[model samples]
Target: MSSAGEAPSELTGAFIEIAKVTDLGATGESETVVGNTTADVSISKDQTNSETNKHSQRRSVRTKTYNTLDIEVPALLVPGASQLETMGVVDSDGEEIYGDVWDACRIHIYDKEPATASSPAQTFEFENVEWDWSEISLPEDYGEISFTGWVHGAWRRGKTATS
Candidate 1:
């Protein structure tokens, strides 16, 4: 009865390893998203001067550049279905996906568990991500992380499939 996105080993402390977009940048097939994890990258600027001098207009700035990879993972995803289709759950011919199918990712993030052939302190490749479970068990708790905005020809860098 192994579930919760089926751990599949390799996850120690702060974690994040996901791959789609045809294994984005290559490295160990990819699919290990653990939590209590937080990683944010930003560079969103292209002028918004003053939101039309807002008193209510509310449009200050931030053209794009977002990776809000945030969530709690000890209970991991709502449960079942290959840990909920590796956090994007229901695809690859399982059907049952709705809204925000943005999919298109490449992430290798680790603040720990890396040494023998290490190099995954950071990497980024994002395209319309949607690791949004939004409600995966709360009689307890768990799950989130998505940020690939601000377009600069889209960022990419992945190659940490150590051994």
Candidate 2:
């Protein structure tokens, strides 16, 4: 709540990057998306938990910190590029001989300006991530390529050091 008559502030200038590599390496036209979720939860919510259901005023401790963010991903490995290209399995015609799987994926979250020599920008870095594209339901609804990410590690929130 805002103090007295103070206006409620909003946060902006935040961005996210999705990559096929743990280091977040890729190149191409940044993919753009328009995300619209009618309703959802960022983390796991188990209502039967004794602590949250009975002890914590209907708040679940299991969902206190989300290892995920729902920001627009902004882009992918460029249009017309196959998953094999993303996995570095492209052939002469840029085709994958076989499907590939990821061992480790990375996501870099920057709420403020990216790392610079002078100022420390606020950022969130997910070391290892597992992500997938959601299936689109047909006929009655518009088709969509939904991106869902699962981050694994401590909740790291701090200023980014200058590179």
Candidate 3:
């Protein structure tokens, strides 16, 4: 809430943490550790609609059809390789590992530095992400080998550390 004379709070792209669930123990709970060499995060929700008309009366219906998240990051040999593998990307051993639909990972994007009392963070727990990018690219002007993936999943978003 803001007073009449005060300007509204604006959210900025800063303080983001992206993690992948690496393990699910016997208790069925997974663990997530922050990813490295990440930049340019994007998330989207898409809906589809269908309409039926009878006797000049129109009935419209809409449903959530797709939820996707994309991120660009420098390629890492260790953790990044494993992360991609979890998303069903192929490994060096010519094996593909996949997670169940119930599996999920956490993504936290903050409006400000975390622990700042004034601004809250948006956390997305994404489930069953299907990887859309498999190849890596190296641009002429860049030193980092960047990789991008389009992930399709169901995500829940909520504010954290709200005032």
lDDT (Cα) of model 1: 0.40
Q: At residue 1, what lDDT does model 3 achieve?
A: 12
Q: List the candidates' TM-scores in order.
A: 0.24, 0.34, 0.50
Q: What residue pairs are clashing in model 1?
A: 5-83, 64-150, 65-149, 65-150, 66-147, 67-147, 69-145, 70-145, 84-89
Instruction: Give the better candidate number (2 or 3) by TM-score.
Output: 3
lDDT of 2 at 53: 53
CA deviation > 4 Å runs, candidate 3: 1-13, 22-26, 56-102, 110-121, 138-153, 158-163
Ranking by TM-score: 3, 2, 1
State the lDDT of candidate 2 residue by residue for 11-41, as single tens digits: 1234433344332323321222222222221
Which lDDT value does model 2 have at 140?
21
Q: For residues 1-163, what per-residue lDDT tens digits would candidate 1 score against the true structure? A: 1122221222333555544553433454444542223333332323222223456866665343432332223332233455445445455665544423333455566776444326567555554454434443323222443322222224444433434
Question: Which candidate tops lDDT?
Answer: 3
Between prediction 1 and prediction 3, the one with superior lDDT is 3
Winner of 1 and 2 under lDDT? 1
Residue lDDT tens for model 3, 1-163: 1122221122134555555653322344655543432344554333355555566656655554543354444442334454444444445563543322324555565665545735335655555554433454423332334444444544455412212
